[model samples]
Target: MNITPSLKKVIGLCLPLLFSISAIAQPVRPKANWQNLDLQADGMFGISTEKAYNELLKDKKPVPVIVAVLDGGVDINHEDLKNVIWVNTKEIAGNGIDDDHNGYADDVNGWNFLGSKKGNVEFDNLEITRILKKDWYKYAYADTTKLSKDELAKYHQQQKLSRELNDKLEDARKNLDLYTKVKTVYERVFKKIGKQEPTLEDFADFIPDNPMEAQVKMVTMRELPKAKNFKEFYAQSIIDPIKFCNEEINYHLNLDYDSRDIVGDDYNNSNEHYYGNPTVNGPTTTHGTHVAGIIGASRDNGIGVKGVANNVQIMSVNCVPNGDERDKDIANAIRYAVDNGAKVINMSFGRPYCTDKAVVDEAIKYAMSKDVLLVHAAGNDNEDLDKKANYPTPFYNDGGHADAWLTVGASGFRDDQTLKADFSNYGKQTVDVFAPGIKINSTVPGSAYVEYGGTSMASPVVAGLAALIRSYYPKLTAVQVKEIIIASVVKVNHNVDIERKGKIKHIAFADLCRTGGIVNAYQALKLAESRAN
Candidate 1:
């Protein structure tokens, strides 16, 4: 089947909606249980977690398995998640000392890498920005004739980074101005309407005499219909973008910003282990808590959405910040999780580049040596990861890739030509499998729940299944668990339309990933049970 130019434009616009939290909040399909429904039976293309728990593991007693949530932070006090959080038995809580002598003090639940003895690190520059700024003097007035191969390469990288950062900073400034303008108009027009919730018809009926009012009326009438109500429209269009611009301007693109000063650790020292505090759930725990809820939110508790693994304990390991996670923190977080007995580790964050790829590679190798499974998000860039690199990838810095690592792409609820998530990054070699990521309902911070969409959400679904498998089949090695997941995928036997080169192209879904299918909890468990020792 060939895609028309018009259809391609539609697909391109539609795909990005999967990544926008506000866009997917009110889906087209009402009463959508698509993420939880069985694909083979219901045509929803989910992991069939409920079916597996109800039928396959009905009578079996599951051994408790610890899965690590390595992200910004996890809300340990979440109403639905408090019970399933991992507790360190050997280490005493709030003693002001390292009772277990594990180099961390008062780590009752988990350690926070974004925090230090002084305070929390709120924002950080990208790894590339940091590297470019560090070597600015060396490359600023470089003699190309006298430069070595490595030095020239570094110079070129710095040039590329300088351009990218300048472009992003300029774009962010424009967006902030545009959003601020639109917000002022929205507020003025809304006041004139004299209603809490104004509809498109209300805007149409509103007569704007002034030029400023006319601009607001035009923009609001055009874009307001996409939202469910006034609050959502204001939040999504005005508030969120403004906040994002502020972060970009003040934090991400700020080359002079040093979060390590607050962290008070030598970030270059990969061996500096004990520098963080016991604040597992930092200022914002929404992302990490949501990932944790997807992996091991208590099943049969009747409080919130059920996690994929019922008998699993979530170990929170904080490292990520609002912008980019440092490689040193990521390596230490992975090592900590592995040393503390996490069989499966879920990393839902990634950057376009890394400054300390070698350190991260060593940590991955350490996890692999410990027979631990690492599951990572394929990223929401909608690009081919095999062609373009995503940092902290399956590929190692030294030589080979991590064998036990599973990179996952996001799968939508639909089982049609557009089954693959519009925002998912696909690669035949890079991404191993797919899972539910569109409009995923999970736990948020403040003991609340919300729907979020990203490869970040998709990763923990696979990790939860890994935990479920290891819980029942305790003797199966991490390598065996990885194989079972990739082997037992429910193949999508159809040609799907995916965004490529800014246009929609019809390609076989099987070709999008190595597994060519979505992750199936039921099938994975069946495969694991067959091989269980």
Candidate 2:
């Protein structure tokens, strides 16, 4: 599977210590596959999902649980995922009418909130960008003479956003031009050297006569030594810069464009529903398909990696886009999943700003009321969630938080220096637990697989564990399951080093999250069995 440049930016920015395919060639020990393994007599951190299935759930009549993948979209036809995909018996497939009369016409599997009657929206600006574009004057250049406290606060926010957007755009444009020029020079020098892979010695031996030739030689001389071959050099100098430039040019800085128009929904009206297409796998299925496979890809299929849960059905809910997911769409997606019998909802997308957080908050409460569990990614930005807000959070306006919601931070396989994922956001109060997210191998759009990492990957691991717990126990409430998972965490009793503000600081692992430990499925099942007895 080809990872697009923009996706790398989106996924990479979210995660600070991402392992690129080109970067890490050697595989770590098999035990480092923490997401799959169970804890042995030796102290290792893992969910122990497969171990539980083998020892406990093998002979048991496991109940099937519905887990929702609410993200970009999912490829319902992926080889390992085909049989596990949820099918709606009440609604007929390809029938022009609403068979179930649920406002959606022919939604046999799931709904696509990111698409419309016209087509699907692939890319969009962030909500902060939209705020800057629409309300620039209110905060861009305000007079301090006669302003209320609320007005002054808003003005400051607008000014900050404007500065960030402009600065990023300028940096991207400059780097794009620099990379383009460097690539042109590097190619010409390689051709002159008459080698497919040029070396520094080759450049030093050849002398240039003209100004253009001299410039080419200068750039190649400095760059060739860093790369072992021409392919690596071209990718770094040409591919990465072009990808960055294209994203800035086409979406982020493109203020005049609005992808929401394609959806044909009243963006201002949070109450308005029933507007999207039935095509769940809109434009790109890479992100969402990978997420779903982690939750419950068919076990013993002999094709792809087995998911956490063995007896589960995946409901694809398309609300996230290549860019930011709107608050309205997210709220509706949650409500739809809950109403359609999704017991566990996994949201792997979020942004720094939200247009209408109240609606989303209300939807979360509604899910809680229905006994549905929401597992969210703690975001890739390595910041404190207690200080900075990641939208679609369980924190409500009523000054209370949702009981059935779990905010997960990313963890690595090792329990030493690289224990926590460098890019994962941590919070002593806001975030609940940690899970394996580094170099996760999962299913992509085609009948292929790839290694991707982020808190996005971490969230689904917990969601899959939730499904596994509910499937085996069958009597645990959403809140009870959340507590069991948190209570059963394998606590890290020592201090760990973490990078913050460009400096490594030794802090207690307990300070990183409310639960100072990682989620353990074997422990959780043991607790559940005790509680049941």
Candidate 3:
């Protein structure tokens, strides 16, 4: 079986991370320092994607690479993404028996750690919500069966957990209602400023090198058609305050977090030989599908936007949920991707609380052992990771350096006006680079597409960039790619233009983030080429 397919069949591999490739139409004489190039204007955003494709092809090579997406299932049948699925030639599709004997019965595309042979993934939360309310009806709050004194005490203990969860839910519901009210008021005020959309249309494509436009881009206003003050409207119009509040509530406050009670198995071990099915996609694969499209969606597919890399293979490793992901599943997914021949792993999700570190931490060590680069999201929380805590970090260098893991944060759409998004996490201690993450148009399930924002979107942009470097340079170690991304990021505007309190603040962008820059493929190519020498 020729597991190494032709590079032409691969989609994202064509993007050359090195300048010497066919894509580098006019290269400068080689130099020692890594070169940098601006990509926002020269990028493939506004112009026809085909024209961008040709320019890239002139100095690029299409190579196939595998990126493991440890998130909700990926939409395999997406219109712009159908051609890039990583098919398993080692085993026949839909075979009841494990033909390849790799433990999974028939992983045609990749394994789904979250599902079974029936292919369902709408599982519950991390903490079970069932115990609450039901037991509230009980008088003695005991199972009322033949129970010893010790057993009776245990029953009450579990019942207490139920009460705590219901209280948490009540608080969350109240918070949501409050946020919705604030957002509705702002929506009306923002409309008086601009008649068309809720967002500041005046902010679009206005690349301001000056400070005044940047001013109009940072102010927040109350619920009134106040004077057309760009600064006041920019703050409220650009951010979805309710969405941010809800995401925070969902992760931290949900007391009945364990929604996975239906699986009927222990999550602490890997003893189960076969747990999932070949029909890997689930009901809600929007997040993974969006990330995948950003990395390797087929170009010139006559439907949607082009992916970052040109020729690459996408493998589904469904593990994370809408809620918190377990350490065991994450650890297993990384090992699985490495053992199955993935050169790059894109983990666009992160959690603050990980009590069990053995399975996933060992998996990180295993990925390093197998020479795979792991790209992870730096989280969406606006706190600085240096002072704050974030997991799945790449920094093992005690003396001030990075490891094999690269953490990326979200960069806003308008690079000039308060370029740093209000929701993106930043840190000189951990975060390596920033990328376009605001309202990105990407693939969704069933031949559809939608715009989403998060470090989830940023991680795969770097992952695709990693694929480009691996395909072109081939000799660069996974650790080296991590360094290149960090060192080669383009320093964008130093504008502090985000919402805080009831108004927008104008601060330097560099002050908000560690790198104070965004990822540029053009510059990364030059850096990769110069460093190779």
Best by lDDT: 1
Residues 1-533, model 2: lDDT tens digits: 12222333443232211123222221243343358786563334567776777677677777989999999889999998988898888998887689998888988889998877799988888776788888776655678667799888887777788887777677667756765665676567667778756666777887776776686566555544434355545554466556757776678667777888899988888998899989988885778998898888888888787798888899998988767788889999999899899999999877788878899999999999999999999987677999998888898887898999999998876677567776678999999999988767678888776556788999999999999888888799999999999999989887766666556787888999999999988888889888766
Candidate 3: stretches off by over 4 Å: 1-57, 126-171, 175-261, 270-274, 395-402, 498-507, 512-514
User: Stretches of candidate 1 above 4 Å error?
Assistant: 1-27, 30-33, 40-43, 143-149, 196-234
Candidate 3 per-residue C-alpha lDDT over 1-533 given as tens digits, one digit per residue, 9 for 90 to 100: 01011111001111111111211121221111011113344332211223323454457665688887777778888888889888878888865777888887778888877766444555334333333322435524455577678766757766676566556556446645654654554455446445434434444433444453333333221211321233323332333333433543554344434444434447545444346556557754777888888888886676676787777889988876655566667777787788888999999877554545545566777788888999888876566788776665554323323258778877654445535645667876567777766455678788876555567777888888888777777788898887787677777665645544435567776665567677766566667888877
Q: What is the lDDT of candidate 1?
A: 0.80
TM-score of each prediction: 0.89, 0.85, 0.70
lDDT of each: 0.80, 0.78, 0.60
Worst 10 residues of 1 by lDDT: 4-13
TM-score of 2: 0.85
Leading candidate by TM-score = 1
Please list all clashing residue pairs in model 2, or write none if there are none. 14-380, 16-423, 47-521
- Comparison by lDDT, 1 against 2, better one: 1
The better-scoring model by lDDT among 2 and 3 is: 2
Look at candidate 1 and tell me the lDDT of residue 153.
91
